[model samples]
Target: MNDEKFLKGKVALITGAGSGFGREMAKCFASKGADLVINDINMEGLEETRDIILKDHKVEIFLAKADISNSEEVNNMAKKVSEKFDNVFLLVNNAGIDSGLYASLKSKEDSYDKVMAVNVKGAWNVTKAFFRQMKRQRQFEPIRGKIINIASCAGTENGINPFFGVYSASKATLIAFTKLWALELGPSDITVNAISPGVFLTPLYKNDPKVIRLLLEARGVKLPIDKIGEAKWVADIALFLASPTANYITGQNLILDGGMTISINKL
Candidate 1:
């Protein structure tokens, strides 16, 4: 951990913090001295994440178990956070889901609705509920608020796999929102940005690494790094985006694809 503590005295809210990128980001933010408010639909997973953070970082952690897809639930969670912390300096919209391979085609309506609900609406609900507090914080305090959306590289790619169409569309929606929100909030000094990651070895593949490798290989996805990414890689980027260093960078989609986007010929 860096001793600089750039995020000292800040409060950060991370969605889908049960595991994967969100979990790692939570840990990274906590290490920098920010108090945390982490939420997930999975209570057990949320508890595990809280315990892990508590073990290493001494920052306060508030565990909220709420399904981000539900607007009412998300609004209530936001109220709770505001009541507890009064303001949140960092908001990481990291909750998302995807229909299993080929399932999007088989169950188009269900898959599309589910993916959109969690990925698109979930981000909207949380942001809408917290935007006022963020703006207020910017006005009264010296800190600037940040909203980091976790989009996917599939959103930017022109020719995506049909099996991932719904998932891709949802992420694309989020990327669009990131730009729009940045424009709307820039005047208030609230920076909004999106992160489009290519392939990261998170808990999603703990059970079947070979399957993921074959999927990427079949797509002719070759990166200069010649390896998949880690959750820590994404977490580090989140840390940078949330820190003061990223004050001037807004409305940009920072693609952390290990040069894969430029290396591979577009399909």
Candidate 2:
């Protein structure tokens, strides 16, 4: 029954904090008393996120504009974070991009590269930069800190999708990373976990009506959860894993799809 603000005094760094799960997670963590360091390419969106969070929590917040795919920028961001925050207890590698460049497109490789650059490489750069710092420092109990990676169930279950090869591959890689990093970082007590979100009504889904419709149709009649998931759902999961309660959890990917992934296939 330890309840004196789970995230109080902890510092959390989240990429893609300008929109979707990243933005919502920022607010959730702040509400629980965690200081924030958020990164995103959209300055306006980032500002909006900051404004919304400032309304309730009185915690330190740092907003940085940078593309996660840029190694230099990510490294620099990590350095700057180290300068400002004394205790960096959580890292959420949530900055990702989904290019609708299906395999049918002529320049599909180009699209795949772009998606991989952001979805996969970006995650790698940010994690490597931040984890290096965590590995050096000695702080909080059970686990020094936590890293929650946002992956997709598409990687594991729906590899047969018509044109989502690249996206699927990237997610598969993330899943593998979760397993590998858990083993590598277990010694230092730094837990690494992944969340494979099935269908969510975040900004990503908001962008394309056709895609949304397709997901709805694919789900069939009487959807599992009336509507798609909100960013808050993913955020809550991320916050839980980062909290002290999930200290014993690591190397596992929790699927959050409103029960979408567990359904029996019917065609």
Best-fitting candidate, scored by lDDT: 1
Over 155-220, each residue of candidate 2 has an lDDT whose tens digit, in order, gives: 666432434557777888888888888999989889999998876777787756567668657646
**Candidate 2's C-alpha lDDT?**
0.82
Off by over 4 Å in 2: 1-4, 104-107, 158-160, 207-211, 218-222, 264-266
lDDT of 1 at 185: 90
Candidate 1 Cα lDDT to native: 0.85
- lDDT at residue 266 of model 2 (Cα atoms): 47
Question: How many times do residue backbones clash in model 2?
Answer: 0
- Lowest lDDT 10-mer window, candidate 1? 156-165
The models' CA-based lDDT, in order, is 0.85, 0.82
RMSD of every prediction: 2.1, 2.3
Question: Using Cα atoms with residue i matched to residue i, what is each candidate's TM-score against the true structure?
Answer: 0.93, 0.91
Residue-level error in angstroms, candidate 1, position 226: 0.6
lDDT of 1 at 117: 93
Local accuracy of candidate 1 as per-residue lDDT tens digits, 31-139: 8999999989998988898999999988989998899999999988988887799768999999888766663456568777888999999999999988888888854
RMSD of 2: 2.3
